[model samples]
Target: MIAEATEMLLSHLVLFVLVLTRLSTLLMAMPAVGVGVPKRVRALLAITLSVLLLPTISNDLTSSTLPQIDNLIELLVAVAREALVGMLIGTVVQLLITGMQLAGELISSTGGMQLGDALDPTTRANMPALARMIGMLVTTVFIGLGGHRYMLAALMDSFQTMAPGNVILHQGMMDLVLHELSVGMSAGIRLAAPVLTALLLTNLVTGFISRTLPGLNVLAIGLNINAMAMLAVTAMAIGGASWIFSAELDVVFERIARLW
Candidate 1:
């Protein structure tokens, strides 16, 4: 009984090591949990969670001893495959957040608010204050909408559908990710359109004023008018941001759920 128990423990350990490789890779590349985090911390967290998950996911991998190969080359290849799969999924999610940042940039550009910047605590990088604000706002909405739980649920379900030994790249999923990226960029453009339109109209009016009022310093006057116009439009747009967020979140979740 003692020998049998020891053998079972060893088998579990082996399975855990394999499962951990994939989880670590995902945690390293995925957004929110991955970006700007210390590598050691990500590794520690991944190993700890993978250890907890091993028993649940072990069936997805081979329990039998590894087959003979040219040294450890094949084993390394398997590990690489697991890591690649994890990164692929994680990157898709990361790009989604990048889409949000791009939206922030477009707003800042059109609003004549690009001069403002702030340090982002979440990303630990210097970003436009507006961008940082939108980022934190999005993260808050994500939590409020229970998106994090869904992410974890997706991560857990992946083990069942994509075990270690049978790992294969899904080209169809990559295409879907590409489609989502393009859609996200378009959404950003749409979100910034109203403000941009207001700016354009303001410019046209300023140009006419310059031509008619020869005594006035039009360039100086136009700058202040542009600023005020942007402020007004931004305030108006903000009231509708929640609806935009809800619609965008629905699409994001729909795309994420299809990975399995």
Candidate 2:
């Protein structure tokens, strides 16, 4: 009886470690939860989530379902597989934010906002003010729209469908990632289109004015005009930007669901 109990405890412990590995990787890859969060806090959250998810995961981990991990090397391999699965899911969700940041970069360049670059805490790099603002706005909107919850739901679903240690690294997965990346790039361009158009027109008019009044300091004036135009157009198009981001997010989540 004691031997049986010992075996059971070991099995449960292994399961817990696997669960914790996946959750830790997921959180680390996640944008809002991972970036800027302290290690201690993230670790605590991972532990708590692993504990909460263990019971459900236990039901799915029968002898037939669980991978054979006879030794430490095999266990490590299983853990690595689980980590990959978690990273894939988190990366899929992160693509939306990446697209939005791309839009910000375009807008900032067009509007000459690159001079106002600031240190982005999340990325630990210098980014244009507009790019940072747009990134934060999209992140706020994502959280406000319950995107994090949907993300968690998808993670939970992955466990049931993909199952830990059962990850199949295939060409299809690579294709899916490439397709999502292209979609994100196109979405970013589309999001910046209105602002780009407005900025283009503003520059043209500024150029014409400079030609008409060569004595005027048109360089300085044109800069101010471009800034104002960008701000105005962005304000007018903020709603549409949010709508596009939300739609893209839905598409990303749907693709993630189909991965299993």
Candidate 3:
């Protein structure tokens, strides 16, 4: 009877570990729940959530049904797989901001602001102020869209539809993720398009001013106009694009779970 009881305990352990791994992975990588928060806090949150979820999950679906040693190995693999998926999702979200950052850099370069650089508090990386602005703006919209809640819902549903023990990720999932990458890059370029267009126009107008009016300081005027134009465009875009962009934030996160 003692040996049987020990076996039952081991089975439950395996299942709990599998779910714990999934929860931990999501917490570690998902926005708001991931890096922005402290590690200890996140762990505590994961634990609370896991306990709440454990009762609802069946023994057959968890470590509770497995023998002790088998449960341990399965639990390890299950947690690691969940972590891999969480990391993948998290990386996609991070790249979206990086895309915006790159666009800002391009705009800066064109506006003759290539020498400028600064530290970004959120990313703890050296980034131009313009890039930081663009990245921060998008991140704000992501939060405003309730992206964190949506991510959790998607995660919970994913377990229901696809059990943790299966450990199977279809190839089509990569293709879908790639599609998100394309969408993110496209959005970044679109946000910076006006600035880029205005910059090009500035160069044209400045060249003509320099050629036609040699006495004027074309570079100085060009610098001021470039700065003013970028500011104006960003301000205008932010006003209208905030809602549209925020909607996409939810879509991007959902793609991970909903897509093939």
Candidate number with greatest lDDT: 2
Residue 31 error, candidate 3, Å: 2.1
Q: Which is the leading candidate under TM-score? A: 2
Taking the tens digit of each residue's C-alpha lDDT, what string does model 1 give over 1-260?
A: 99989877765654566678778877776556775578788888887888788766765456443222234676687778777766666666555555666666876776667778777664677677766665666656666777656656667776677665456677866786797687667665666677778888999999999899978999888888888987788777754445566577677657666766
lDDT digits (tens) for residues 1-260 of candidate 2: 99989878887788888888888988897877888689999999999999999899888777777654679998888899888778877776677677777888999888888788898876788888777777778888888889878878888987887666665676766776787788878878888999999999999999999999999999899999998999999898766767878888888888878877
**lDDT (0 to 1) per candidate:** 0.68, 0.82, 0.70
Listed in order, each prediction's TM-score against the native is 0.81, 0.93, 0.85
Tell me the deviation in Å of residue 101 in model 2: 1.2
Lowest summed lDDT across 10 adjacent residues in model 2 is found at 163-172
Give lDDT for model 2: 0.82
Native-to-model Cα distance after best TM-score fit, residue 142 in candidate 1, in Å: 1.7
Cα lDDT for residue 54, model 1? 74
Model 3: CA > 4 A from native: 59-75, 121-124
Report the candidate with higher lDDT, 1 versus 3: 3
Deviation from native of the Cα of residue 205 in model 2, angstroms:
0.9
